[model samples]
Target: MTDVSVERRGHIAVVTVHRPPANYFDFALIHDLADAFEGLDAGDCRAAVLAAEGKHFCAGADFGGGGAPGERVDSSRLLYREAVRLFRVGVPVVAAVHGAAVGGGLGLACAADFRVTVAGARFHANFAALGFHQGFGLSATLPRLVGAQRAAELLYTARKLTGEQAVALGLADRLADGADPLPAAMAFADEIAASAPLTVRSMKQTLRAGLADEVAAATERELSEQARLWATEDCAIGIAANLAREVPVFVGR
Candidate 1:
């Protein structure tokens, strides 16, 4: 079964990440998402909703699996390449983040033009907590969404933000008061789809001018830092502690 699937909801294409449970992504899943987004360009899709089928939007990547740090870095670079394609897509996207969007998952949601989340949803930039440098172009995207100082605070503290907090900080666009955020996001997309498609596309491109280039450059720097940090003793400790559900005691090795 494909991890990513696209369905039509009027003029809005719903691109869903179908990986079960936490929907932790890897290089393959990222490529699938890119493909789904690209495929929509040929259809009647005037807008899109990016959502997931799982308990969380995405819990992040699984680094605890057996792999050399070098291998992990290599895989992450490939994933980021596909992730950049998500930013280049033509249509405006609204993300429905119903559960936790942690680490790179948070970055994925930020890639969308808008996000609709629930009050109980969570957003976190956990790279620092993992002793890992941020990826998924968050170094650029986060600062763009929430400003430099707020992004710095989030990255440095690695704190979790509630959905309401995300909206208050302008990290998320809307908070769904109802149970499911997908319908809210689709409704928002429908509103966008009601507009002239060409105008919407042009406006979206204009608003996001040079953003793809910025994200590409940021990913390069992020990957370079992550390549170095992935091999650190502290990173390993953090990963172990996360899997064990314990507070990580970083010795700053």
Candidate 2:
């Protein structure tokens, strides 16, 4: 069974990440999403809305879940490789971020061409707080969406931004007035689907030219730094503190 489901709404595809509670990601989830997007490339799917079926959109990777039940290094590499495929999809995607999109989840949202979020929705780049380098190509995507200075602030401070703040910062494209954001996101995708499919696809390709390559390069660099940081005592402390819901004390290690 796949963790993702793709349903066609006219020319728009609604891709739901169907994990409960936090909807954390791993290698399998990434592969599932890649496959879903690849499948959407066929048929009449001209645009897509990426949404999650949980309380929080996604809470990042489940660090306490033991990580995909495989060799950690190999799994991480495979996860990133599949994640890069998300950027290569031909159809433009509008992400519906209803709850929290944090860490890698925020990167997933950033991968979309546009984001539709509810008022109280949260966006965070918590890599530094985790004592790890940002992954999922966030190094490229975050700055691309919100500019260098804002991206640097979000990463360095690891502060959470509400939907309105995210829109103000250019991190999110639209803020829905209601509680549910998926309908608004799907509406946006439907508007895109109303256009000429080929023209839309071509324009998207032009607008996002070289983005996948940039993300690929950024992910490689991120992984390299993360590998080194994963061995540090501070990283362990950060993880422990997060799990305990407390503040971490980093000794610059």
Candidate 3:
């Protein structure tokens, strides 16, 4: 089964990460998600909810998926850009993030206009721990909420953050107290649907212009950083070790 799925419900578009057990995948799911994002019709819809179908939202990358180190993955960029386009469709987006929002999964959540998270939800980068580069325009989106220093701290430390910390960091706008956040997100979408379309579109445009600039900057940053990592021994060593099921020891090369 594909890890990610998209379905339309009434005027609500729901995107779910359905990969079970750990809820993880790499290029496969990321590409599917990008395609799903493209096919969504938020203009006719009231709003969209990004939720998951397992015990956790997403456990991050699928190291076991077996893709080359640099296989030209524009999925992350495409996903974020499509999100920008969707927000421009005169409809709001409210993400219902339950469980783990790690790495690129956090990137997906960050693209949403607002996020409603369950009480026990958790978030983290966890990339630094694995010695990899960041993706999904997080270079731009994350700091907008958590400040540059805080974002740097999170990335550098690869610390796991609880849903409470996520709310405190402004990453999550609302907490759902063990309740399913999908209903609340749909309600928010309904509020947006009932509002004047032009006004909504205009505000969305005005807001995203700032984010657009950030996205551009982030694209450059992500590219440069990833490109640099592509050549480093660290990336090769880490990836190789994972493939071999052995511990990678980096000499800071």
Candidate 4:
């Protein structure tokens, strides 16, 4: 089965990520998503709904495969390059986040213009817990969504928030009425499609002017910090503890 698929519904494009269970992403997955968004931007699509077919929207990157920290950082640089391309998509996007959007996964959701989630859905910025700076352009996007103070708190604590709490904090835009978020997200996209397409696109461009450049710059800083931290013993401990489902004990080194 294809890992990524796009279905056209009227003027709304429904883009789906097909990696299962946790839907942990790598460079390939992120590249495919960017390609899909760019395709929609060049086509007749007015808006898009981004949804994943899995128990969780995305659990973040899979770090179980052993690699030296420097090697990992090198691989992540390419992935983050594609991630920034997502912010350059011209049309509006609504994410259907029915389950966990953790770490970089939260960054993916933030790439969308809005999010539709269920009450039990989870949103987490877990980079701090992983002993690295947040990547995927979250340094710019998270603060844009929820403001600087809330973004700082979320990043520092790596606190998990439910869908309702995410909406309360402006992390998520709407709460799904049911367990499934796809219908709600599609409906939201349809609303955008119903608007005058040219006007909507122009307004979106005006509102988001310079955002892609901002995200690009922010990702550069994030990458440098992450690369430095990835080599640290504290980061190693943090990754091990996370994989083992244990709370990490960090020592400043």
Model 1, 203: alpha-carbon shift in Å? 0.6
lDDT of model 3 at residue 111? 74
**Candidate 2 runs further than 4 Å off:** 66-71
The 10-residue segment of model 1 with minimum total lDDT is 60-69
TM-score of 1: 0.98
Question: Per-residue alpha-carbon lDDT of model 2 for 1-253, expressed as tens digits?
Answer: 8889988878888999999888999999989998998898876799999999979898888777544223555677889999999999998999999899999999899888999999999998988887888889999999898899988999999999999999999999999988899888988988898899999999999999999999999989988888888778888888878888899999789
Alpha-carbon TM-score of each model against the true structure: 0.98, 0.96, 0.79, 0.98
**lDDT string, candidate 4, 1-253, tens digits:** 3589999988999999999888899999999999999999998999999999889999889888879878888888899899989988899999999889999999999999999999989999999898989988999999999999999999999999999999999999999887899999999998899999889989988998988899999989999999899988889989999999999999975
lDDT of 3 by residue, 1-253 (tens): 6767767887678888777756765566656665666566434665678778877777766655555545534544444454344333335668888878887778777878888887788888866755767766788888888999999999988788877788888888877766577787777777777777667767887777777556656766776676567567787777677568677787788
Candidate 1 at 152: error in angstroms? 0.2
Candidate 2 lDDT score relative to the true structure: 0.89
RMSD of each: 0.9, 1.7, 3.6, 1.0
Between candidates 2 and 4, the lDDT winner? 4
Better of 1 and 4 by lDDT: 4
